[model samples]
Target: MISRRAASPKRSTPRLPHLAGSAFRSRSASPLALNVMTIITRFLSLAVLTLHCVAFAAGCTADETSTTTTLSTSSSADASESTKESRVLRHAVFFSFKESSSPEEIDAVAKAFEQLPSKIDSIVDFDWGVNNSPEGLDDGFTHCFLLSFADEAGRAEYLPHPAHKEFGDTLRPHMEDVFVIDYWGDANEVTDAKSDDETELKHAVFFKFKDDASEEDVAKVEQAFAELPNKIDSITDFEWGTNNSPEKHDDGFTHCFMVTFADEAGRETYLPHPDHEAFVELLKPVLDKARVLDFTTK
Candidate 1:
């Protein structure tokens, strides 16, 4: 992490005391004895200086070690703060009810899901709606729900919460096909039903690659997908990311891409564009299963 404050310099070693030669001199002693006394005093002073140097070096090492530990701790804390500020975990769910299920039953399931955030504290945001796309590409899925968490830990808490399990029980009997994709990305802050009161069309596409697909093959698909906006003119906004949730709820889908259109006319132009057709062919060889959910903001 980048530090806002400047680093301080290391403290300097202190000076040793000066030794006086006159203290070692004995005026009453003979020349040889006086010479011996002077030598012994000089040796003892040199030893004291050596010991001081060693102790000073050790102190410097200790200071250096302490500073390093402090900086490491500061960086870790800053990184935690950055993660908190920049990212959010998104839980994307799509459900297709069985033929035997009644309208009242589906409504109950939806209401039960809406009430989950009240029981599970980890869910920070929730949104749900019925499908409203004309493309007929949703693979039988009719309802969609999006749940947001502040971080992965919050998501972790939400998945196993009793409320979530209860909601699952409500959904299981009527569920036909379920597709889930959770990932970390920028938090959604679009609270308005429509942008400027005009219905906005959203194209949510989920992809599951073949088990044998190489990393290179996946990269190629990603590159081709990203190039669609430039190849087609109707795409107003686009974003893509990989799954990161640990809930095991993804059901083999690993990548999600969302494209926003200003209106249904924009989406119609994109569906049959030559570039898009070509991109689909590129995805076919390594693609395992794919699902799409297109909806207009209510």
Candidate 2:
């Protein structure tokens, strides 16, 4: 009944010597020291931020340089490929059949020559036609056959082909004269604009430069010939190159130019064209022999 009051709980203050000392020292610090420390801290933060920005900018520049280099290389490669695709080796053949050969025999010879392309894989394209130009400029040639190849190697393969040799054997009997000229030219596709139906007149011009003609003279002649299409409205297409055939059958003809027209009217217009006449005058001095054959595509 008379229980003693529970002993009162002891009240004790917690020890904080380290915290108290630090707080007292901070409060006693000079304003100049505090400002100096704040300035140093801000300067260090800015320096780190500047370094990060510099690193990021350098990385971006390197990436951009790499991308630009790659694009340049790709563009150059594409341009080279386009140039290669546009060029080809052309083998042009002109024939004047013997008077003794009948039409049926000539037709057989034609059919036999046509078959060589199918047999020889090197022949990329083949086309033939009889002379139809009223200009009387074909020099006794009656038939024109144009064969296309990818390069000199393709032409090399074609020249010695067994099928081509057989075709030659078949053609030699009735062939009064055979003119072969090979050159490099544009690989123009026969599209609607240049289709056989529209642009069929082919004016094949072959040249044998004089021994006295300098390289520069020949170059001038070649340049003048190339400019004909630009000067004459009737010229639908024009391509030219030097002969590079290994067959030794070109008979000294060095350069070949193939000019296309829509019809005989176009040919008629082109022949008397002032530009063409001027070109001929320019060519006269350096030219040794010139062979021109005009035909409509069959």
TM-score of each: 0.68, 0.73
Model 1 Cα lDDT, one tens digit per residue, 211-233: 99999999999999999999899
lDDT of each: 0.82, 0.83
Return the clash pairs for model 2, or none: none
Candidate 1 Cα outliers beyond 4 Å, as residue runs = 1-25, 30-40, 100-108, 133-136, 156-173, 188-201, 223-251, 259-282
Collision count of model 1: 0
Alpha-carbon deviation at 230 in model 2, angstroms: 3.3
Q: Worst ten-residue run, lDDT, model 2?
A: 190-199
Across 1-298, the per-residue lDDT of candidate 2 in tens digits comes to 3354346565587654364544435755568877876788899999999999999999999999999999999999999989988888888888999999999999999899888877998888887888876656677989999988887788878877888888889988999987788877787742224454543788888888899999999999988888888889999889888877666778788898889888888988998899999999999999898888887776
Go through the candidates in order and give the C-alpha RMSD of each one to the true structure: 17.4, 10.6
TM-score of candidate 1 on Cα atoms, chains taken together: 0.68
